[model samples]
Target: MMIYTIRASRPDEWRAQRTLRLEALKDPAGSVAFVNTYETEEAFADEVWQQRAETQSFIAEDEVGERVANVAVLVESGEEFEEPQTHLVGVYVRPEFRGGGLAAELLGAAIEWSWELPEKVGRVRLWVHEDNHRAQAFYTRLGFVRTGRTMPFPLDESRTEYEMVLERP
Candidate 1:
């Protein structure tokens, strides 16, 4: 097993972040795991990635310093929801690192960051593709429960994405 270090991403590490994101978009499960495509993300300017890195983004790097996993917490606020919520997004782990508890580590990083935010975040939520049973099971193991709310998958309207939440304790 390869040793991995999990840490927050620096804004200047946009290149590394972009590379890993593109790699994740190419995964076999990428179709349902992510809403962005390699082509679309590849066209983003360096500054765009830099701004993304500044957000609550965390990455797991291998011994060789390759980013093997990533997750981000996005703060969402509007009249649509009762209170502002922290959303877990862009979660991905390289195939070689799967089933090694890296996913849980990534999520823990995001949740920790969420609790430290200046604004009071009521809960942490994530959307899992209804067809992605592996991801659903993984989230459940991490204490996320289905909210019985779903939205159409942006990439495929015929499919659905279920909303899962972990209430703030």
Candidate 2:
């Protein structure tokens, strides 16, 4: 079995974050999985990447120390949310490191972090592209259920993105 070390990414690791995102964007499903075009992200200033690096993002590193997966939990706060909530963002596993439970581990790390946050979030949610059945299946297997809520895909309004949520028990 392959062993991975899951940990929070430091702010100074924005370069690593940028590299991983670019790699994910290069994947075949990249066009559907991510809203950001490679060109747009590539053109972002270092400050943008630095801001992202400050988020509560988890990274899974292989035995050789190569970061293989990532999952970021964005804590949501607003009048709409009765309690603090977390939204899963940028969830991805490199094409090569998939199928070894690395994705699950990355998610677990992110969720656990959310659960222990100062805000004490009770719910975690994510958005899955309507056409991305593989991702929907994966989220379902991890106990996430569709909320039946949909939003126009950011990149294509005609397409949809469905909201899925997992309540803390």
Candidate 3:
């Protein structure tokens, strides 16, 4: 296993973000977790990257400086009774890095980032494939509990996702 480093992503690394995202989308398990296709991710504009990096995004890089994972934690402002929250998205660690604690590290980093927001995010949430036991276990180990929230995943008709959340300390 290679020793990898993780950091908050930068606007200039949008291309790297695009590349790693596509690679992650190509993974067999990715089809269930992500809705974006390779081409769609690859085509994201620089403006999108700039806004994301400045506010909420992180990336994992290999020893040689290539991006291998990209995770984003975005906050959605709430209107009446909406209950503002932070959402976890674009979480992908290269297949090669699986089982090396990279996913947990990514989630921890995102959690840490959300805690630093001045508004103080109350909860962090994400949608995970209903049938993905591997992911469910991983998330459970990290303190995410099923909210009993279910919705049809946008990308696949046969799959459903459960909303899970971890509250801020």
Candidate 4:
């Protein structure tokens, strides 16, 4: 059986975080799933990676100590929302580790962290590509509902993305 642990990432885990992100950016859905490209992220400075590690990011590590999955929550503020919103992003699981509940675990960590924030967060939100039905179903199964908001995909403006949200109770 495979053994793994899910937990928050530390500042010193920048290297591991970068490695995992690079792997995610190479996946088939990477173009639609991530706002940034692997080539762009590869050029980021070490400090950028460190800052990412310091964010509310969680990682799933295998028994051999390799990071196999990651997710993060960012508290966002804008005139469009009445209260601060917790935005979940950077969700990815290595292909070999997919379908093992790792994505759910990562999302649970982000949701739990959002609820524990110092300030009140109105809800948790995430964007999934419109063509990615698998991800849409996954988020729906976790209690998120489509908000009917659509935005142009950054990588390909011709395509669209949908916003899904889970309100805080």
Candidate 5:
């Protein structure tokens, strides 16, 4: 079995972050799973990634020290929510590393980290592409329930991305 070291990504790891994100953008499901395209992200400067790396972006590196998966949570707050909220985003698992517990384990870590956040997060929410049933099922199994709320996908307003939330316990 392959062992993985999952931890928060550092600004210095921007190159690795960019690499993995580009790979994810190349997936067949990328259109629905992610709003960005490889070309767009590829053109971003290193400082952009450095800034993004400051978030609760977690990465999983395999035994050989190769990044195989990634996940992140963004703390959002305003009139839109009662309290500070952790929004799950940027999730990806390399094709070769799918169909296993790695994603779950890494997500659990991010969830645990959310609860530890100084902001006192009330819940963890995520957006899933309307047609991405596989991702929907995975989130459901992790205790997230549909919120019946949706917004127009950024890239294509005609399409939607639904919401799911898991209250912190």
Candidate 6:
């Protein structure tokens, strides 16, 4: 595998971000995990991509400067009863980029950012499609544990998503 660089996303790179995200969303595995379809992905406006860059998005670039993978951490404000939590979403790697440990690197960076908060975040969590054993295995390897909290799929009630969490400890 060729050496690649991982860094925070930049607004100027929104087009590249869109391209990579579309590719990821088109992947077979992405179909279940990602919420976008090919048509919807193609119609996303430039502003959406820009906001993603301005927010907590990270991308892995190849030696030639192509964005091959992306992992974004979106912070969700907690209600009165819950501590502020960080949601890990939009994680994907180019089909060719899989198995190179890029996902781990991207996820590690996201977690590190969450831990940097002045008031520590209670935990980092993500939702994985129940049938996505590959992703479950990857998250497990990264020390995330299943919390047994399940939700119906947004587009398909027949399928369920499992809530998984990784504690700072």
Question: Pick by lDDT: which candidate is best?
Answer: 1
Better of 5 and 6 by lDDT: 5
Give the winner by TM-score: 1 or 2: 2
Local accuracy of candidate 2 as per-residue lDDT tens digits, 1-169 = 7778999999899999999998888888887789888888989999999999999889998899888888887999889898999999888898777888889888988888888888879899999999999999999999999999999999899999999999997
The candidates, ranked best first by lDDT, are: 1, 5, 4, 2, 6, 3
Residues 40-113 of candidate 5 have per-residue lDDT tens digits of: 99899888988987776888999989999999889998898899989989899987888888989889988999
lDDT of 4 by residue, 36-144 (tens): 9999999999999988888778899999889988998788977877888899899999888888888888899889889888778879999999888889999999999
How well does each candidate superpose onto the true structure, as a TM-score?
0.93, 0.96, 0.89, 0.94, 0.95, 0.93
Off by over 4 Å in 2: none
* Least accurate 10 contiguous residues by lDDT in model 2: 23-32
- Candidate 1 on 40-65: residue-level lDDT in tens? 99899888988888877899999999
Comparison by TM-score, 3 against 6, better one = 6
Q: How many backbone clashes does candidate 6 have?
A: 0
Q: Look at candidate 3 and give me any clashing residue pairs.
A: none
Per-model RMSD to reference: 1.4, 1.1, 2.0, 1.3, 1.1, 1.5
TM for candidate 2 is: 0.96
Could you tell which candidate, 1 or 4, scores higher by TM-score? 4
lDDT of each: 0.91, 0.89, 0.82, 0.89, 0.90, 0.84
lDDT of 3 at 117: 82
Residue 74 CA displacement from its true place in model 6, Å = 0.8
Residue 93 local lDDT, model 1? 94
